[model samples]
Every structure is written in C-alpha cells, then in structure tokens.
Target: MDMYIRVKRSKSTYFIRCKPSDKIIGIKQKLEEIIDQPVSDQRFVLPGTGEILEHIKTLADQKVDSDAVVALTLRKDVNEFEEVNIVGPNDFYQSRDADDANW
Candidate 1:
C-alpha cells in the first residue's frame, strides 16, 4: 500500500519522500485542491488519547519533501504563552517555539 504523509511548517508544506512518486508537489497540489482547504487539516490521532496533531501552513520559497514527519505540537491559548498546559494526548513538551525543547 502507498503511504501518504505531509510535514507542514509555518506556511509551507514539506511532502514526505514516498517511492514511486514522480513529484511531491503534484500530490501536494492535488491534495490541496481536493481538500479545498489547507494541508493543516491533515492530522493524526495520538495513540491512547484524544489529542490531535494539526499541521501549520508553512511559508513559501522553502523546500519540504517526504520522510519528514510533521508531528502534532501542543498549542497554548493566545492569551497565555508562559503557563504550560497539555492538550489531549499530545505528549506535549512545553516549548517556547515548539521546537522539541520542552520546558
């Protein structure tokens, strides 16, 4: 079976490196077109919990390809940026920028 994956950054999307793939952009664009929504919606459920990993739209002029696992990072209220709070089964590690460094 062919596996489909996406790793979204800030505003740009990094497509996973899947074999038998002619081009990543083709699939990405097709998916985007089909979804009629940003790739951010492509989320997966955290095992054992009800947490979801939502992809953020990445910037353009960037390179993203397959093999990149876009993980679901925890989100904080726009109001609170210091106080840490866990969201569902995110296994969320408090990060000032969600860059893997958990406080």
Candidate 2:
C-alpha cells in the first residue's frame, strides 16, 4: 500500500508520498530535492525510539508506516549531523478542533 511520511526539520515539514517497498535512500532523495542538501548529508530518525533509518533498508523493513513522523538532520560544517530539532505547530492552529469549533 502507498504511504506518506511526515519529515520534520526545525520549523519545516515535508509530506512525502511513498510506498512500503521504497528504500530509505529514496526518501533522502526526495528531501534532497526540496532542501537542497545531498542525500549523503541527510539523516533520518524515528523520534519516538531514536532509531536511525538506514539508507539500504526499505520503509517496510524499518516498520515506518503511513503518517509516520521522521526527523531530518543535516550534516554541519564540522561534518557532524545536527540533533533533531522539530518545532511544534503554533498555538493558534491548535486552539480548537476543526469538527468541534469554527475557524
């Protein structure tokens, strides 16, 4: 089945459409297109378990399902990957539920 992952980095979020059989490298490639960072400079992690996603593995192999939250980290000048830094949505957007309250 097709799946979409939410890739987060700092204050930006990328909704990537993918398949279970798609490799982690494919995801990196997608990110590279939008972030202007090479695949070699990109890193992905599961925020919940802090597990690093391997480029050679498929999404199914990593148990990354639809709507999964994957954190993106990029290599810095020192050649070290930065820490996961995802920013939550602003309070105004979370003020009320869409179905229960008016915008």
Candidate 3:
C-alpha cells in the first residue's frame, strides 16, 4: 500500500509517497537526494516518544501510516566540525592523535 508522509525539517516540509514495506534507509536516501544531505546525517524523530527511527525498520514495522508526519533533524555530529591540525605533508597520518579518531 502506498503511504503519503510529511517530513518536516527546520523550516521546510516535504511530502513523500512511499510503500509500507519500504525500508527507512530508502526514505532517508530519498530525503538526502532532495535536500542535499547525507543519509548517515539524517535522523527521523518519532511523534510521541521523541525517539529516533532506526534505519533497519520498515514503515509498517514502525507503525507509520498514511499521512503521517515524520520530523527530521541532522545528527549531532553532522553540524559539528572538528579542527584538524596539519603537520608535514608526509606526516598527515601520524599527526592525528587517538582522540581524533573520528576525523
């Protein structure tokens, strides 16, 4: 069955038509394509619990129905930029400390 869902971001709202059996990651990928954001950086907020929707689940598994509103926010790390300390050209790999593993 096809479901129409409303995705609300900061100020923009997107209307998407999907299937109940569709994976959440597929939805995130579509949103990423439309909004120029990466799927890894996207978070879908649940209505009641304020919980994030997991990508492994399908729309039906999440109890998301037709005309459902799915709130979206960027992951915390998405907006955060880590400072990189560049050493010599050949020492780039060694320059990063253990604390900068994420970088």
Number of the top-ranking candidate, with lDDT as the measure: 2
lDDT of 2 by residue, 1-103 (tens): 8889999998888999999999999989988889899999999999999999999999999999999999999988666999999888773266566568876
> How far off is residue 27 in model 3, in Å?
0.3
> Which wins on TM-score, candidate 1 or candidate 3?
3
Candidate order by decreasing lDDT: 2, 3, 1
> Residues 24-46, candidate 1, lDDT per residue (tens digit)?
34444555664464443333333
TM-score of 2: 0.84
lDDT of residue 29 for candidate 3: 92
The best candidate by TM-score is 2
Candidate 3's displacement at residue 22, Å, is: 0.5
In candidate 3, position 57 carries an lDDT of: 97
The residue pairs that clash in candidate 2, if any, are none
Q: Which ten contiguous residues of candidate 3 have the minimum total lDDT? A: 80-89
Models ranked on TM-score: 2, 3, 1
Compared with the true structure, all predictions reach lDDT values of: 0.38, 0.92, 0.77
In model 3, what is the error at residue 14, expressed in angstroms? 0.5
Clashes of 1: 12
